[model samples]
Target: MHRVIAKLAGLTLLMLSALPSRAEEARQFRLSVPAEVAESGLMDYLLPRFALKTSRRAELVGGGAADAVISADPQAGTAVMARAGTVYALRLTGENAAARRFADWLSSDVGQRTIAAFEPEQGAPFAAARQQQAGPAPALDGDPALGREVALRHCARCHRTHDDDRSSGIGSTPSFPALRALPDWADRFTAFYVLNPHPAFLRVEGISPPFDPTRPPAIIPVELTLEEAEALMAYAASVAPADLGAEIVHQ
Candidate 1:
């Protein structure tokens, strides 16, 4: 009888311990930011406000490039903030349908309000463009060569194109060592590029075009039409490494 009683007590204690952990998990919400934005220290300014507005316990995690927020017990509420573009509802709970509805609403008016509040100087064209869905689209001609050409012409200025160099490697200029490597690279590049164009990258080391923050954001002036961009994206999707390909899909 004593042994059975001890076992029952142990089970009770175990259940008690699990309750808090399960509650914590249910309340937790994670926010992930790309590496470039984190480097710029944008999260330092943005996160506190979000925590305060949502009345949630927030912790910032991950130091290198990516920034993430683990919010515990987020209050059911909505708030808005603006920067490069308007961000509506700083705390979005993936599990809550109401949070999603609020996000959609904020994506329109409140998003505009937030943008106007933070970056008043940015032009309308850039603002509107940023809000649009910028993910990879369907291909134009289904031609890998054409995609390579588009990448070389538009992206080669900042990224390495060949397989030889010091940055990526000896001949690794930013273009594909294999098409499978593209999805994650594309995801990282797109996230950073859409958020903000790096002015410092305009001029290669020893090259001209003095870095200027005041200049309008550099638009990649798509030489390829939407269809071509899609085709290039498909080509990129085909050859990236397996793990990177999964990350790209997640991003």
Candidate 2:
């Protein structure tokens, strides 16, 4: 009889302990950001939109108890975004699907656009930070021929990869050569997988995180291995930048 009572007490304690966890699950996610960001009202504008899109609620918490913290400290974790020239990293200390969802949202097209659009009083809008790179960009190590073929297959549908392929590509999209003309073109292409539109449909095998089920691609999805993306970059680099220069003079 005593053993039965002890067993019942233990079970009751277990049930009571699980109650908080169930409550936490209902709350979804708890995130931490710098006080400056909270004060700037970016969260007020961002959270509702996030909830509407992902059907998840993210609550703000103090640093110690947060599932994730957006910090300027690189040692904290991986850099995810930048605001006003300050790079912020995502430091995830605990596991929560909603927390991961919020992180993905922060780096997604909508999140980036929202962050960039928010104009804080007397503050610069947030910007998408580039992928971390050490020193100058290395020289191309791919075959121009192979790069061209890769580019033709993957990129040409929306970008003119060559002068002979002028009939191809959407009018609104910039041509490969035009994009190559920009000084930061390499960086842009390197980070394309994580940026808007691409993240919706493009999966990079083992490199990219799995797509969120709550927000699947509206169009056909595309998958690429890291090697393929690299080859595409090599091909883009091979293109001659358009010489946008001197005005014509009629004598």
Q: Which candidate comes out best when scored by lDDT? A: 2
Candidate 2 weakest lDDT stretch, 10 residues: 130-139
Displacement of the residue 178 alpha carbon in candidate 2, Å: 0.5
C-alpha TM-score for every candidate: 0.33, 0.52
Residue 186 accuracy (lDDT) in model 2: 69
| Candidate 1: C-alpha lDDT | 0.40
**What's the lDDT for all of these models?**
0.40, 0.70
Best by TM-score: 2
lDDT tens per residue, model 2, 179-246? 77766676556656654456667776665566768878887777876566667777777788887677
The all-Cα superposition gives candidate 1 an RMSD in Å to the true structure of 17.8
Candidate 2 at 127: error in angstroms?
A: 7.1
